[model samples]
Target: MTCGYARAVERARAGSARVPLTRASAALRRWSQRSQVTLTAVLLLVAGLLTVGIAADPDWVPPATFLLLEVVAVFLLRLRPLAVLGGTVLVCAWGLWWWGAESITPGFLAVLTLSVVAIGVFARERQRLGLRGAPGDRMLVDLRDRLAAHGRVPPLPAGWRVDSEIRSAHAEGFSGDFMVAGTRAGGTTLEIVLVDVSGKGMGAGVRSLQLSGAFGGLLGALPREEFLGAANGYLLAQAWAEGFATAIHVVVDLRTGDFTVSSAGHPPAMQLHAGSGRMELLDTVGAPALGVVADLRCAALTGRLDQGDVLLLYTDGLIEARGGDLEQGIDRLMGAADRVLAPGRGSAAAVLAGVRAGDDDDRAVVLIQRA
Candidate 1:
């Protein structure tokens, strides 16, 4: 008992000695997170104000100085950009009234007007969307990278490569089309889901981001037969206004060159057999898109990829157009694939670039080539 108590006392002393350092480190981290950006903005404003106030001629200071500071503050103090904007405007207006009351300074007035607009937009975002900016942007960066990284199929055994690409509508930063892939069973099995969320570009960015993360987690969690059902259930639960989405699920056995595919109202997946050099559809027709119906059971289609064969999965944006039908788009894509890929050296990005149909919409293409 004495030895145990002595040992406990010694351990307590050790932990107590480290507590101060741990707390100091945490305090430093918190300060750095907010201090760096905030400090930089404040220092910039102070320097600008000092430079203008001490100038031999006020005119030489430039009336646009505060405006530049306001703009910089909006990005720097994005956590409360409007506050920074308001403060800047008030300071500028006050200075104009006190120092140049008789002067008609259109520049400061213009800055004030622009600040009001920024404030209004930020107000709308807060009241309607309840979204706020924070240092959590680091978290968002990680998530965005996760969404892109998951699309890269895990390193395949020799002689196999999966090439994928995604482009947002209007060439924006986000797209409705995304894919999540994983390998299981000693890296011999590869599973993937190519999803097209309801909207396009940044309009569907949030949905795409959310679904990509969820689908990535579910990629190898459930049995192959239950993967789609689970994803369908998840979407239905979201119950969003424009919740329905189309997806193609594929599972391949790398060793055997066998794969099973299923669709959720998505465009058909195309396969090119090296032996025939013909592209064929591998779609389970008549299945409903995700979140369209509950307890949906989609039919699966099976296929094989021989040596030098390729499989293509893509979003509707790559094909759908005004007054265009499904088969029409497929036929056009087949012809393009034959011409571009017939050389046996084409890539997914090449196929995406060669196709001219989806210029007005977001486009994504994934090519699984078995070399």
Candidate 2:
């Protein structure tokens, strides 16, 4: 009997040892996937750029030299994005200089476009990997720093904890969803904002940061209604210069167990009750998207929260994800919400997962509960 018990303990230890090995193996596989994806993306970008250059300037370089340089650059780019960007710029500059007297041809324009887009994409990835910089990289750097603060903020005054995550899919564009939460007025009110910016890539990303900054400033100043109005004004100001951004912002009062919301061209948020599977889409009776109109009065919608209830603010990207219909995506999100907001798993991470899975674009979720 003693020997049998010892053998059982040994088996359990062996099983535990295997679990970490399995996890490590999976992690290694994902790393390999990222490496291959980076290599392939760089290769395609180089090929497209070179093809355009050759088409634009037929006599730019001797064939042997151009081909040789292309091969060498591709080989170097597997390890260095700056090298790739440098090579592209040099080749493009050389081609343009060689064809100085000729009109810029369609092929040249195409190559230039490819070079710009590829550089942007590669720069974003390289910055993520601690490699290099590009135009607007500072904005990305600011965004990254803010995102790293998710779920790390102080607890809500009412004793509710904030849960959050920011993850970019293996693609371009801002999945415009982000969450911010903190105690207000020394724990009298709980302010949480879940916003989704319209558009994708750099433009969408820029707009998202703008919205977040606006909301952050307002969360500490005005009442929810005034904050909504301010958000509309901010949007209008931005729209006048560019086009527009859609967003939903909310302030939850832990003292009164009530919440106020203001939305601008953003999807209606939802609330999942703490105990049951019931869900209700919050009122989004706000004005049109920000930047479209000035002095737009955003309507303030209100609701009450019982313990275990989750308020979810998300972007259309969740509902209008590419691979599925809006209804299907919403249904999937609702289902996920039902599972995560269920008793015992009541945290920000739980709700974020529900919304994250539905994202085909920028996505975000915020959850606040009573202490």
Candidate 3:
């Protein structure tokens, strides 16, 4: 008890020590943002002066080098987009008027014009996003990283191998498909929830992060059967017009190879039997797609994995095709999976990479193997 108390006190002290550091970091970020406009103005002024110097002495440095100022303006945009854009225009116009036919040759003018157009495009994109700099993109990256943190499978005892992977539509940095996992009873029970948020790619990114965090907590805190109902409740509370989702919640007993699975309007998971090298669907049905209906009628599906058996969980994005049936998509996927998850080749990542369907949406897969 003394040791526990001592450790708790140490953690409290360490946490307290970080307060000042957090405040300092936040203050520093505010200062940087507040100074961006001034910094961009200064940079533009310097670029203008440098351009004048280089243009006046064309012999020292080629007047064509003045085009480099436009490139500099692009970098300055992260500091302040509209200001940098207006300043770049003024500087370029003044230089063209001051030097005219001599240093501001047609070739130089052409390159500068193209660079300015590119900068304008970038500025418009930033404006559309209502973002002044790279912070928005960085925030998305951080959230994606956090979601990945929750998906990490806990270290289990020998004879159990579990792995997962996801791909966003159009090669985005984040996806609507994500997984959150938890372990109970000293890592003997592994629980995984694979969710596919409505929409795809970056369009569904924010919702994915929000629900992943909510479900991650629920998975760790709630009973295996209570997870979907609670997740549905959480989503319903959000009241987003399009906040519907489909999820598969699974719990695996590492020691006995016994598993229980359930889904909320999600595609079925598949099992690869080690004996006959056959893949069979779990065919478990539950409530309607999450957030769609208030009344949920979820039923638990139970099964056991013999030695060398493999269970595969995936998002619809992996098998779905435009203007095609869902079951057909599953058939094609299983055929490909059978070959990929065959006795010699036991890699879920390989199966995901090999199957070439559902490119229009995000795809994710989790494989549990009893070795």
Highest TM-score against the true fold, candidate? 1
List RMSD in Å for every model shown. 9.8, 16.5, 6.5
Q: What TM-score, computed on C-alpha atoms, does each candidate reach?
A: 0.81, 0.58, 0.81
**How close to the true structure is residue 28 of candidate 3, measured as C-alpha lDDT?**
48
> Candidate 2's C-alpha lDDT?
0.57
Which residue pairs collide in model 1, if any? none
Q: Highest lDDT among the candidates is held by which one?
A: 3
Candidate 2 displacement at residue 186 in angstroms: 1.5
Off by over 4 Å in 1: 1-29, 32-56, 78-81, 84-88, 94-104, 123-137
Better of 1 and 3 by TM-score: 1
The reply for model 3, stretches above 4 Å from the true place, is: 1-31, 50-81, 84-88, 94-131, 134-137
> Candidate 2 residues 1-371, lDDT tens each?
25643443344234222312234444544554366557546665765565465556557642233344444443334335545544565555456547662544556556655655565565556556433322123335545555434324565554565555554443553545566555667777766666655566655554555455555555555555655555655565443445576666666667667887778777777787766669887767457876677766777788887776767766665567566886787778777777777664655556656566643455555555554
Task: Give, for candidate 1, the lowest lDDT window spanning 10 residues.
Answer: 12-21
Residue 363 alpha-carbon offset, candidate 1, angstroms:
1.4
The deviation in Å at residue 51 for candidate 1 is 9.6
Instruction: Report RMSD for candidate 2.
Output: 16.5
The TM-score measured for candidate 3 stands at 0.81
Per-residue lDDT over 1-371 for candidate 1, one digit per residue giving the tens place of the 0 to 100 score: 25643443344234222212234444544664567556656655664564455343556555455556555544334445456555555665566656654332666576667775776576556434423333333434444565676577788999888888888887777778899888999999999899989977555876777777667666776678877877787788778998988999999999999999998998989998888888887767678999999978889999898999999998887677789887787787877877777778998888877778656677888888888
Q: Residue 196 in model 3: shift from native, Å?
A: 1.1
Please write out the lDDT profile of model 3 over residues 145-213, one tens digit for every residue: 776776888888899888888888988887899888879998899999999999976658768877877
